[model samples]
Target: MIRGVGSYLPEKVLTNAELAKLVDTSDEWIQQRVGIKERHIAAEGEFTSDLAVAAARKAMAAAGVTADDIDLIIVATTTPDYTFPSAATLVQMKLGMHHGMAFDLQAVCSGFVYAVATADSYLKNGLAKRALVIGAETFSRLLDWTDRGTCVLFGDGAGAVVMDMANDEELAAGRGLLSSALRSDGHHWEKLYVDGGPSTTGKTGFVRMQGAEVFRHAVGKITDVVYSALEQANYTVADLDWFVPHQANKRIIDGAGAKLGLPPEKVVTTVDLHANTSAASVPLALSVAVADGRIKPGDLVMIEAMGGGFTWGASLIRW
Candidate 1:
């Protein structure tokens, strides 16, 4: 099964108390509501590629594979070291990989799910034997520190999963990724987005979002996509061994779990510790769960996420 996972966070940790000095929010307000105590921030010299490479190395080590064992490398992120050369390519270089296809995928916070789905496809199609899928973000580069609402909700980190090819018949009979359901609506694009871009402002921009509006969509969309993936896999909510949703907000996670009739114990949450690493949230959460033995082999797992660009998706894996 495609289940080699790894994750990495920066060395620096920022506590809510530390954040209070920069914003008007109180540690009590943040912790009581969002369940976030601290988040890791990238050092000045660190980039998304750096975090990605660290995670990739760990995954490869855990899987007993090397860079040459990978036939594909997909790095998902909204914040890249540069607009070109792609953070994926940079990661490939750092891994000393030269033969694999490498590229980046952008779907904001849902990027990890998207990357996972894409990697699954490559393996299922026999186009790749092994693939490294990474979600890395240096969100500190995109924050409006003056805005307390969004500023306190993000951090920097990376997580990765290494997947290998398997026959579809074998997958259907219990092998790897069984099914994936994804969707996006451009109509809600402005609800959460950056103010600048290469073609637009010719500059990198800060994140701006309506927290309340995003909160409304997140609960509904995440729950729906999870069900959608289950349906595609011919399974039900009760079949899930674990619900590793995007670690965005505690309220959203709790609400979605309640709506799905899932007990709090089934939900794997790290938002309290990592805040919202955006694209890196789900994989980071997945890695944490896997590392802690919360998610075991042969488990039926479902992953879902929603983010800027209004992008979101879900995947069902037979781990």
Candidate 2:
């Protein structure tokens, strides 16, 4: 069962107007193209793990579970404090958890859904009793500030959730994760990717994307995965109570929701507020909906995301 959710955005805000000063684009152009008004940027010394730990602490409190209760920790991100030690271990240490297994998963923006599915499998198989799944990113560090196309489209943030083994009664009640579908196509990786990596250049790289190509493929890919998940859960579009998609772009979100025939109000969007926080987007939107009392217990929620590497996935959850 998904026990609790939480999120954290850094204090600094970068407005589209401010971005115009750095690039040739204006606020009007950015808003028309990406629908982002502003985004949050992490402080100089604040790393991905710092944001992850802050979000994790809130999740633990909401779930009423202590650090000792978590037997597994999985953090999903492309940006790690170091390439050696997984970001999950860093979060584990900060949370004072020492007895559990911890690791990191990198699926770019589709990371949180991937992590959730992996964590669910471990819990179902009794590999762990409780798991902490976090989607955290310092994407601002990966942006080319001079390239307005990418820089204005990303931000930094973290979001997390606590999933515990549900009892038989809870399963009978349909009160946890229902089904998930994941897909990837490496051929289209160049459509969106980082320019450098440890193996390639031994340096953290900036974000690179073919915006038109990505936009062309996003709706179709997202709809396929979402429908696959819905089918696995024995559900249809009418059965969906909410659609929390990755906050990548307003155009993509609207396009996918429209293709699925979901009403505007049923879609949970934070792209305008946070831009694309990469892996952090979906969980951050989920946190907002939950905290606002829009997503209640017994509600059926659907989540989907597509990121660099052409990775895309969807998961069905019964809150």
Candidate 3:
């Protein structure tokens, strides 16, 4: 079961008007195309690990658990502070924890959903009792400031969830994660990816994407995985209480919601406020809905995302 959830965005707010100053795009064009009005950028020295630790602390507090109570940590991120030590290790150190195993998972925007499934498996298999799953990204560092295509579409933020083994009673009550569906096609990797990487360029790279191509495939791929997850969980669209997809674009969110026959009010959207935080998007949106009392316990929630590598997945949760 997921015991708690939390998130953190940097103090800095980069508005569409501010982005217009850096690139050739304007506020009107941005909002009309992607529905992003502003995004949060990390401070000069703030790293992905910093964002992850802060969010993790809040999730821990909300779960009413401490470092000693958590036996596993999984951080899903594309941007690590360094290439050697994983960001998970860095986060664990900051939390003053030294007893548990920690690692990182990279599936781009689909990372959080992937991490959730992984954590759930470990706990179910008796490898762990409690786990912290975090999706943190300093994506601003990877944006090409001069390119309007990708620069205006990404931001920095983090969100986390605390999960532990669920009791038979809770399972019988239909609580906790029910099912998941994950898929990927590497052939479409070039459509949305960074231009460089440590192994390829000996330096960090900038974000590069074919926006139209991504838009073309987003809705269909997203809905397929979502439907598959719902089927695996023995639920249908009518049983859903909330649809929280990736916060990449409002158009994609709307398309998926409509295709799934979910009402607008049941979809949680934060793209206008936070832009796309990559791996952090779903969890960030989930955090917002929960904080605002839009998502309550016992609700049937569906979360999904599709990102670079053409990776897509969905998870069904009985909150």
| TM-score of every model versus the real structure | 0.97, 0.99, 0.99
lDDT of each candidate versus the true structure: 0.91, 0.94, 0.94
* Candidate 1: tens digits of C-alpha lDDT, residues 143-192: 99999988999999999988886566755668578888899998998889
Candidate 3 or 1, higher lDDT = 3
lDDT of 2 by residue, 1-319 (tens): 9999999999999998899999888888988998999999999999999999999998889899989999999999999999979999999899887699999999999999999999999999989999999999999999999987789899999999999877889888988999999999999989999989889998888899999999999999999999999999899989999999999999999999999999999999999999999889999999999999999999999999999889999999999
lDDT of 3 by residue, 44-68 (tens): 9999999999999989998899988
Candidate 1 C-alpha error for residue 100, in Å: 1.5
Prediction 1 global C-alpha lDDT: 0.91
Residue 181 local lDDT, model 3: 96
Which pairs of residues collide in model 2?
none
Where is model 1 more than 4 Å wrong at Cα? 167-173
Pairs of colliding residues, candidate 1 = 298-319
Q: Could you tell me the lDDT of residue 243 within candidate 1?
A: 95
Error of 1 at 316 (Å): 0.4
